[model samples]
Target: MPLATSLAIFQSCKIIGVPKSTRCAILRDMAKVRKAERRPPLNKTHKLKRQDWAKKYLKTDFSKVLWTDEMRVSLDGPDGWARGWIGKGQGAPVRLRRQQDGGGVLVWAGIIKDELVGPFQVEDGVELNSQSYCQFLEDTFFKQWYRKKSASFQKNMIFMQDNAPTHASKYSTAWLARKGIKEEKLMTWPPCSPDLNPIENLWSIIKCEIYKEGKQYTSLNSVWEAVVANVGFKKLVETLDKRYDFPSRNHFSRVCLPALYDECRQGVLKDLANVKYFATTTDLWSSQTMEPNMSLTVHFIDADFNMETRCLQTSYFPEDHTGQNIAAGLRQAIAAWNLDEGKLICMTTDNARNVTLAAQLNGWMRLQCFGHRLHLAIGKLDMIYGCNY
Candidate 1:
């Protein structure tokens, strides 16, 4: 039963002391919340086919194999879900499902030998028919990886994809034949078995990363960017696994960290080049360990007039929190980014003497944050009112 029902029962018995949290705790000790597992529908024939395919590939070498698939990401949250919390052993809530027509993008990608193939964004409104699928294969495979490998390598390599209509079409088969991809080299995938495909796991990881923390994209372009970023990060992790046997924490900090930072810094600088003016905000804070840190964030209106914000840097400041040192640290950050001082607008910060002095030292106008002022005002009111409010 739902927690509300239990709460109502307790209320009717005049057990007001048992709050919602207590009820939830009592429920948790007896039951668990679990989402239903999703699986493709499979009949007896499909199950037999899967078993046969599994037996056939039990001893096959998968090191030289490539897996490919296309996935669609929706602007709406992941696969539509509707449910009311119920106790364990209760009948599952019926899912409210609907056909996804628009507001999503389809992307085709592959993974082979610790390397990522094309995260090719399929054109909107275009169906993935036989001819287009063949074209995609030709472009991503033959034109790139296949062309670069030796005859022996190509001969031993296997191409694997799901049994979608386009994959089994006559045109696609003829195209593969022309490319000298024999039946022995083309893996015959079983129906209703996505668990066997490693690329599906990769896709799941990418999706989880993309939609982590309930992230929602406002634009398809942002979705594409996220896809690319997550895919690229996956490739990087794969490369790290392949090259480094056992890299230490210091190794990553000394080597990989700088490379990633430089790449991001360059990208930010390229975007900033077009902007004539931008505002910045800085704040000083301490970690749980009380280690001092300062962060700077840049805000600018892009070409589309959309207000874009970027965290320029968060730097450790072990030095004294004097105005001169703060000013020097800000100057150092500005110099590192190669930002033009003349293009700088006003700086925004809380009413901190050191921060204001730092702005003065940098010869920039400062804007006091109204949010901080309000917070201070509220604190004073609470002090004056005691428990009355």
Candidate 2:
């Protein structure tokens, strides 16, 4: 329970004590504060479905499988990040929120042969149904890309999709069969199990790239542009052919990954050169091994007036987390990216004293993240009332 709630309980029972002393007593009892992990609530049926699906695909080859999904990208952001700076006891920061979340674009995409496939965006207000989904398949994969593939490749290909009504509808199933994609070629995916989909991981990575540094779009077009630009599709087809075995773990980790990172780093640096002013966010984290790390992300509007965000650095910080040390680390990140300190507008971060002091030490204004503040407030309610919200 929160201290206030616990105190209220004790007061009801005619007990009183200092808040600090009460906290100390709780600590002596081996109680400690910890953050809760968020996860989807899965019932027994969902669990059994996942187990069956795992067993069915345990030894299945995924190289020839094409994974597809439809994702909606909002103008504001993926999670509609609400942020502001306000003093204690202030009401929630106000923003002119729009109806239906300012609209968004729904795009359908897939990955096959280790290459990204069609990313066809649906027309505004167009709800996807069986007929529309079949048309989407015909216009995208069947009419163009799939027809170009070799017959042998097509024979061995498998299509994977979630159990959405449009995906599993009788009309869509019949359409796939008519197009030579029979039952055996369709991968049976588990219900409510997106985490098992590799393409879902790709979507997560793409979204992170699109909305780096808390970047938000004012218009749907800008949001789509950001999505298309930062898709970061990997060029894996060349090395993933049947004649060639997959790259050895060491070769990929040590050589290919580093080369890819360097290429991407140069591109980001080139783009940042033209940016006049940008805001940054920083945070410290620790790995399972307790190795400390700090990250810096930059956000700015580009020449096209599209909000853009990119991670500048995530450096291992073995040094003490003093304000001066953190400031020095941030400076190193800024210097690494060839960023002008004068062009930095501010740093957004949680209400950590060291991080706050670090912003001050770097002569940067600090914007407290309202999301974190809201989380803390909600956490108090959870502790006091035993409410999960």
Index of the highest-TM-score prediction: 2
Show where candidate 1 strays beyond 4 Å. 1-34, 80-102, 235-389
Deviation of model 1 at 100, angstroms? 4.8
TM-score of 1: 0.49
Cα lDDT, all candidates: 0.80, 0.80
Kindly report which residue stretches of model 2 are placed more than 4 angstroms away from their true locations once superposed: 1-37, 80-96, 231-389
Q: Can you write out model 1's per-residue Cα lDDT over 1-389, one digit (the tens) per residue?
A: 34346577567767777878887787677776565677889999999999999898889888888888999986544853222367888986443233562277888887777767777788777788999888877777679667898889888988898888999888888889889876889998898888888888767777777876456666676787677666545565567355634444567679989999999989999888898788889999998679999999888999999998889999899999999999999888877777787888988999999999999999998999999999888888989886333
- How many residue pairs clash in model 1? 0
- TM-scores of all models? 0.49, 0.51
Error of 2 at 359 (Å): 66
Model 2 lDDT tens row, 1-389: 54344456566768676585674576557555554665657899989988998898788888889999989888656554555466899876445566666788998888875577766778777789999888877877777688998999899999898889998988988888898887779988777788777778766766777766556667877787666556343323233333534345478669988999999999999989999999998899997679999989999999999999999888899999999999998998898898999998989999999999999988899999989999999999999999985
TM-score of 2: 0.51
- Whole-structure CA lDDT of model 1: 0.80
RMSD of each: 13.8, 19.7
